[model samples]
Target: MKYLSSGTKYDSCNQSAICHAFGPDGRCIQLYKTLLTNYCSGECTYCPNRCERDVTRVSLSPDEITKITWSFYRKNAIEGLFLSSGVIGEPEITSQKQLEVATLLRQQGFKGYIHLRLMPGTPKYILDQIAEVANKFGVNAETTNKSNYSEICPNFDYQNDVLQRLHWTDRIIRKKRKEFRGTNRLVGANDTQFVVGAVNEPDSEIVNTVSEFMKKYSLRRPYFMSFDPVPDTPLSENRPSPLWREQRLYQVSYLLKEYGIKADDFDVVYDEHGFLSNSDPKLELAKANRDMFPVDINSASFSDLIRVPGIGPISADRILRSRPLFEEKELTRMGVVVGRARPFICINGKSQASLSDFLEACS
Candidate 1:
């Protein structure tokens, strides 16, 4: 249990459940997170279980995984399973093994939430089989694009293997939901993940790729796993990507998904290297586009309001509903962080702050 769980942590399924929230039907409450096996054949340079690395390897059978899950479930120790794996051999073969695990668990009368991650090249047929039992499915894109695979994961054909499988998962899930539409039973959600800083790409590239994904593929979410160089891997001597970089990626993704912010809106926030600075991205964007500031509270559209530093969609909605007024306190009362938004917002045509006021407040 310990070895398998540790091996799968690098997958960062919900940052290994540390900094994410899961609240539907309490299905994720105490999930039994682990890998089907730690033995792997792929020679990815960053993984401890890569074919070139020397490490203790273990694999659990479908029956074993099913039994262990039920033992924990019966003891009230867990409510669901989040199972991923080290690629045992071919992608489809490894996925079939995991499908067997989920198949056995279901046959055992365990009707809990099961999240099975498909290997990058796993085909649609096997994906169809697995979706019968798993509620959520994901395939890790691993990095921004195919070019980066040459650096750390040369064996992967990023477009055909990773990107295509993601498309397949999305299509399959959508088709299944459509078939089940009138039954009030939507059973599948799909997500993709990336390893931050592994291939030396900028945040702009990451943001743009993720924006394309959310727009084109209807990606439910994008996961960013901070790349911590593992000892004995080829990249072991390289510095680990900071956790804050991973956090920034999440913030950018949220801005893309919920705020309806375009990827180009973030272009100005990037430094010369095309990376976001170690700061709030929204604030940086707002500061960079200073001319758009001092937006009228009463007349600004929802789109304009969310572009401000401290005003989020919720507060923006509240402001809209309670609008045609005067006073900064109303903004604060509606949930805007007054200190952050005050410099950029105007109430009833009364501009709140000047350049000196902003500079003085900072000083």
Candidate 2:
């Protein structure tokens, strides 16, 4: 009776704001994200809706949620739904309600993207049901370490609650992958979110945990939430994680996952506090490996080209496919952002563009 409301601008999704979520096929689609309810049993110290907090809590029925989502889709306002909820009574109950909303959406033939947040400690049967319907699934591992997790979310079991569910998601995704090979269909991928600067954990711990998750769980990606202290929460006095810190993490994560950069390579990029610099990590790595620089754009391997800032895999492949003896202008047309890549590349055995050349172009 206490917690019933329309919408809260807490997550990346909202009706007016089109929060684009990447699908299994790597296409970005807008999502209609909202909480199913704000009621909760797990009294996490940092959350605004802890059992003791006097916030405006609300629960939307599955039908109500479906109607709103379908309406949004009908207007072409959103391409999908990202549904999460507070732990109401039992975790399973919350999970079931969310599943019901997703099921209702599917039954109504609203076959757009649906990213379901798996509640910690939810039963395996319920997990399977949700997996079948969701286009992507996520379970938030708020903190990196189990001890830190206990400090933040005291009631939750780190092993049985969080990681186990991630394991289940991985298994389901693998099974789904086997079932959906070679078809136009793209099977869902599992992602986890981390609350950066929460529990005073270092960037090293955060990235290490991400590495472990990727290696062990076949995780698709890690989402970073810069911790913002809410008034009345236990961590109200704590400082918010800088947005730049989160951005740097994404850069490092990309380097690790996409660029094939190893964890040990981070030693060159991370500062004394194990925090990454605000500068682009790719540029930092490139500058560090000076001997590898001034790479021959015409002949360098795809791997080498991507190491340079602004040169992505697609553009690198384009370079490979394009006619030999590439000119400076041709690189731009191939999607290689020459400005960023210029300092690191050589065109026909000469530096593609010098600092003065860039200055002249800018002037």
Candidate 3:
């Protein structure tokens, strides 16, 4: 309940749950995110619902879940549903219940977005059924590597269970895309979540693993969840992962997924411990390559524009799209952070702002 109620926005489909989702027509839509049931049989060391102790076990029937979701949807409380559940008896059993909710919603003409979790080891047929009704799918890889998987979630298989399910999700979504031809039923994207700092995995491994997935599968992006120790769990004695580390990962992920920034480029920000430092990755890169400063916004390439501190792909493209060009003040209007970008950008092939100015302004 602590985790759920925290309402910490997760990076799913390039949007946060705290901020509402935009519909196809650009309307904002709220999502009702919840778990189907908290019951589980797996003994993942970090999970509160792991089968070791006498935790409260609760399960909601598929019909009950559908009623609650439908009621909310009809009343305009939510525009969609984000449903997940721990493995009840088997992966298939839990998956079937989720599929039921999706199917029922679709049958009732509920066309809003539905993000469903693909349970590990779920059969291909069940996955196909889920693809028919879901807008996006998620399978949490939790850790970076198989070796780390043993240290963290020993009950689950890294290859056959986790990776294979991700593979199936990619394949099914592709097949659905071909079948639907960009219809609403076509699942737009898939994502994975990683338990950052668990099993002592470094940021490099986590980013690299997600990069590999992006290359092979049709993965949209990866979500980073800071490891928070739950009471009575085996990992309760371990130190909780710093939230700043998770925030750093998200920034790095945006650079990789949105800005086309390569994962190898992260070597510039990683410390001796192989973890990302508290400094923002973009600022660190800028600090390291001082020669690239004072980029001409009017003449700089799209790639170079993104390398600047406060300019993103969208704002950079907006700058490029302007016909008559823009003044220094106009940069902020185009969504550029003038305060952060001033030192790094040149308005008319002239450098005015300095590192000292940037430091002082930032301070």
Candidate 4:
């Protein structure tokens, strides 16, 4: 099946099809994903759409987009549009043009979900307007660490351009939600692809940066696009980030959200080169710092409870609630996976093994 507009097809037999609703009956509702224009002026080191690349570029006119959307809507082929564009000029001009497209859609009474990707360096007013018109507002911070950002996206400055734009849009969305008396429903935040192995940054740094952003900004869900090396980019010869590293980054991110572990609390060690790949970062932390675990599920603090290998936030909560009645062995039998936990957790006043002994065994 065709998943992208680039004439790329997938194996239809291997995939399942799904559907959703639009505003009213007779209206179609598929995600209308397309580029506003393929012509980008930004000289991002990793982007194939950079102005320096010699490729077929297309810019859909406002009228063209409107007509296409309407036809798709009438056929129940799409529910809303996800319109993104390359930086055709400076951010200000590009943002204005993007808003114009959304404005036209609104003026035409197209009320389906509109997801727009804001151009970096767009003025606050323009971003606010885009947020007002679109159902979701997305910005690509690709990498949150400033050093990696500077190296990969050389044309764009993180603090001056990207962060400022995100802050502005975030402020506007929150304010507008308040003014309109909308529920805790948030206007979202979107980040784009990170070039993993192109730079020597660790997964810990990436998770830390994202966690900080979520905490400080009340950001909506963050999307991670795995680094895929395109053949002609400046870093094409650089190896792609290992798949496990990307997966581990996401796993650690989930743990941060679910169990409240700070990135700093977990000490992830790299080999002589970089990035520890032998086991999950959290598991590695518990294994190395035996003093921290085989925590007494019956008596450990919420923070302490989380350090156990197999226990997550929910399991810790259960332990806290059930401890007054259940014995350590009973709790272990109830699917706590105490084999992992036994290495780091304690029962009543005693650990299954001494902290030093456990560390020595794991070592």
- Top-TM-score structure, candidate number: 1
Cα-based lDDT for every prediction: 0.82, 0.80, 0.78, 0.66
Which structure among the candidates has the greatest lDDT? 1
Instruction: Compute the lDDT of residue 322 as modeled in candidate 2.
Output: 83
- Report clashes for each candidate as comma-separated counts: 0, 4, 0, 14
| Residue 143 displacement (Å), model 4 | 3.0
In candidate 2, how many Å is residue 264 off?
1.9
TM-score of each: 0.90, 0.88, 0.88, 0.75
For candidate 1, the per-residue lDDT at 187 reads 69
Better of 1 and 2 by lDDT: 1
Model 4 ranges off by over 4 Å: 1-31, 62-80, 104-112, 144-147, 180-186, 189-193, 219-221, 268-274, 319-339, 346-363
Q: What are the runs in model 2 whose C-alpha is more than 4 Å off?
A: 1-29, 182-186, 352-363
Can you write out model 3's per-residue Cα lDDT over 26-145, one digit (the tens) per residue? 434477666777777788888777788566667666677678778887787776777887788898998888899999888988877788876777888888888888888767899988
**By TM-score, how accurate is candidate 2?**
0.88
3 against 4, candidate with superior lDDT: 3
- Candidate 1 lDDT over 105-181, as tens digits, reads 88888877788877878988998888787877878888887889757777779899888888888888888888788
Write the candidate numbers in order of decreasing lDDT: 1, 2, 3, 4
Residues 1-363 of candidate 4: C-alpha lDDT, one tens digit per residue: 111233111000000122554435332335666667777888777666777777777777877777787788778777666677788778788778878888998899886667777677778777767877876775677786777788888888888777776677667767777766755433444433344556677666676677777676655455554465666778778766666776677676667777777777655444544455757777877766765655666677988877677777777788777766245577665567777776676566666656567799999
Q: Looking at candidate 1, what is the lDDT of residue 105? A: 85
Q: Judged by lDDT relative to the true structure, which candidate is superior, 1 or 4? A: 1
